[model samples]
Target: MSSIKNILYFQAGLGVLANMFLLLFYIFIILGHRTKPTDLISCQLTFVHIIMVLTGGDILFTDLFELLNIENDFRCKTIFYISRVMRGLSICTTCLLSVFQAVTISPSTSLLAKFKQKLKKYKVYVFLCIWSFNLSFSTNRIFYVGGFTNVSETNHMRVTKSCSLLPMNYIIRGLIFTISTSRDVFLVGVMLTTSAYMVITMFRYQRQCKYLYSISHLREPPEKRATQTILLLVSFFVIMYWLDFIISFTSDMLWMYDPVILTFQKFMMYAYPTITPLVQITSDNRIIIMLKNLKANHHQGLF
Candidate 1:
């Protein structure tokens, strides 16, 4: 348990740094292209990542205090509520990125092209509506979550306290869980389908180039590199989030007393945000060049 707690502490510190770096990266990108739709989505994603890390850090700190036998109901409720909403928003933004990129690379004669034109016109309104809906759903956490001690555990020789759901009738609890999970399921589907569409479009473009010798001279890749980058980022987020949900679900069902399980749950809380920036930057040639230039300058400074 001690080892796991130390590792979590390390991760929490890294999460803070990771959020800061990604915030800078996205802001820089936006400055370079002040009006691109994809740039706006990237900024939104980075902002959410920062918020996610901060909220997760709150949970880590609260859990630490609980380990020392301190439990605060207000802190627990506030942190959990904010974390869930931020997490949902993060998923929404990633889905938007995938959909937006797919449209950006769609053929002009396709339905996606028409949708893309509408997206440019109404993206601000769409994003705001998403934000409102996420916050509305999170209101349930205020009623459902609270800090509570595990009175069943007499192993007070050394134990930790954690936030738990406020007990409700089985029907209500199940309903809330179902609704929340369904939203996640829908968003995950959007990301996967759009990503696959982008991949197919790329392949089709390649095949077309092969058949038209005259047009082959003017052939371009079906999708932009940035489109693939955003898709990859969404794929990574989906995988990590699905794994986190599975682990959390299993832990809840087993209702085990192990601290390791709890620590791992907390670790998953930070994993996506902490690693997303690294995945995104590596996928972008511009960011890679900037990083290399910075490294060279740093080496020169050492002299």
Candidate 2:
């Protein structure tokens, strides 16, 4: 149990640090003159991941609230609500990233090309809608989550050491579940569709390359590399999301949280957010260049 707690702490800490760096890098790029449309989407994704990690029922919020001696109802509700909102935002942002990248890499003659110019202009409105939807979608959580008060209570579903999901009316629960599941399914479907489209686009691009250049001489183009990165991210996220969903579903059905199972679930829940920023940072050439410049500047300053 201690070991699992340690792992959770490590996951949250590492995720927070990596995401913070990625967020700063994106901010720098967006503020610069050479920003791409995809950069804004990626930046929002990084920011969402950071909040997900912090509000995650891991080391940060739990420990801070414990130290500050906050009230149980407020602490649990605030943490759980914010975490859910971030989780929703994470998926929404990822799906948007996949779709935007697909549209971005589409050839001028492709159908997606028609929306390319309008995407940049409407990106802010899209983000606003995503945020508003998630914020309201997760409001039910605030009413149903609170500090675990009774060990014998069969009605509560334990989510964290300090927080548990309290029972609500069956109709209400069913309604919330339906709405939540629908949202997740829709976003995931979009992500998979866009990913498949991107894969097809890449294959065609590669075929074109094969016609023009020797196989041995072929190197991935910048667009191809970026598409590959987003594909990898989408694939990883889907796996993690489904795993977390299964665990949540099972626990809710059983009305009990096994220590081992809960620990694994938490790990799965944190895995994507923790891994996302690292993947983005390593794949992005701009971030790589920035890191190298920072290192060179540090050495020069030392002299």
Give the best candidate by lDDT: 2
Candidate 2 residue pairs in backbone clash: none
Provide TM-scores for the models.
0.83, 0.95
Quick one: how many clashes does candidate 2 have? 0
Tens digits of per-residue lDDT for model 1 on 140-220?
A: 868866666663553221112546665566688678879988999999999999999898888887777778776638644
Query: RMSD for each model, in Å, please?
Result: 4.1, 1.6
* Worst ten in a row by lDDT for model 2: 148-157
Model 1 segments more than 4 A misplaced: 32-36, 57-71, 153-161, 211-223, 253-257, 295-303
| TM-score of predicted structure 2 | 0.95
The number of the candidate with the highest TM-score is 2
